[model samples]
Target: MDLFADDTRLTPMPIDDGELWFQQRLPLDLAPDEVMRRLLAETGWREEEIQVWGKLHKQPRLSAWHGEASYRYSGKTFHPQPFTALQLHIKQTVERVTGRRFNSVLLNYYRDERDSMGFHADDERELGPEPAIASVSFGAPRTFILKHRHLPKKVQLALGDGCLLLMAGALQKHWLHGINKERTPRGPRINLTFRLIL
Candidate 1:
C-alpha cells in the first residue's frame, strides 16, 4: 500500500520501534455528527443482556466471519449478531486509508462510564499473523491505551471525535490495547475496528 499520497491528508503519529501509527483528529470526508446519526439509525445496536466469563457482554456483536454461530473464546462458544450498513461504510473508509481491503469490522459502543472492553490483542487465528487493524473513532473522545507485551513503556492516545488509528505490520504480535473506563460523564462512542480475516 502507498504509505502517504498527496490525496491522503493523514499525518502519521510515530511509535517506538514498532509499526503502529495514528492520525489523530484528522478530518473525515463526511460530517462527524451526520455520520453518527446515520450510523445510530441504521446499525441495530441492541443493549446486550448476557453474562460471560463473569463480565457483562452486550448485543449487536458480530464475529470476524459472517453467519458464524460460535465465536470461540477460551475454549467456549459465543453466538454472533448481524452487522449494519454503517459498519460496512466505515470499513471501506479504513480500507482507503491503508490501501488494503478488510472483510470484517468489530463495532463496540461505549454507552457510558460502565461499558468497556477488557485488555486484549487482536490475535485471532483468522486475522493472519501480522494483521493491519484500522480503528476509527466516532462521537465522543476516549482514551485508548496500549501496553507493550515485551517492552517497558505504555502508549496512550486520546481518540477524539473523528479520527483514525491504524495498527499495522507487527503491532498486534507485540502490543495489547484497550479502552480504559473513565469516571467523568461522557457521551456515547462508537468504535469501528476494521480487520482483514484470512
Candidate 2:
C-alpha cells in the first residue's frame, strides 16, 4: 500500500524520520460517551504490576487485551479476550481506513488526569519491522508526545475524543511516544491501539 496516498481525510504529520497520519475525528457514528460507557461496563479492566529498575510497581492505568493473538509486554504475557461487539465494529472500521489487517488490540483506560504512561517505543519483535499502529481515542482529550530517539526534535498533539492517530513506517523504530500525567482536572479517556502480531 502507498503510505502517502493523497486522501482527503488524512493529514500527514511533519516528522522527518517517520510517517504519521492524523485524523481529528473518525466517522464512527457512535457518540464518544456511549462508547466509553459500553467499554467501562463490559470490558474487564485490570491493573498489573510491572517491574522497572528491579522494582515492581502497579501500572497507573487500567488495561485490557482483546483479539486473536496473545501479547507480551513488560515481561508479562496477556492472553487475548474475545472481542466484544463494539470492539469488533471499531476494528473493522479502522481496518477499512488503513487498509491493514489487525489481529490484536491493546486497550488502555486513563481514569483521570493522574493516570499516565511513560515514554516507550512499540518496536517489539512480534510487530515486525515498520509496523503500523492505529490508535483511537475516546472521552477526555490528552496530549500525545513523540520524541526522536537521537535528535532534539519532538511532536506534540492533543488527541481529543474520537480522534484517530496512525503511526506507521519507521516511526516506532526512530521515535518514542507516550501520554504524560496532567495536573488539572480531566475526565476519563480510553485509547485503543490495534496491531498485527506476527
- RMSD each, Å: 5.0, 3.6
Model 1, position 150: C-alpha lDDT score? 88
Best by TM-score: 2
TM-score, structure 1 vs. true? 0.78
The TM-score, computed over Cα atoms with residue i paired to residue i, of candidate 2 is: 0.94
lDDT of 2 by residue, 50-109 (tens): 877778899999999999999887877899999999999999988887788998999999
Candidate 1, residues 41-132, lDDT tens digits: the string is 76655554456677665533322322223344444443445555556566666667667787666667787766676677888787788888
Name the lDDT value of residue 163 in candidate 2. 81
Query: What C-alpha lDDT values do all the predictions have?
Result: 0.67, 0.88
| Cα-based TM-score, every candidate | 0.78, 0.94
Candidate 2 segments exceeding 4 Å error: 1-8
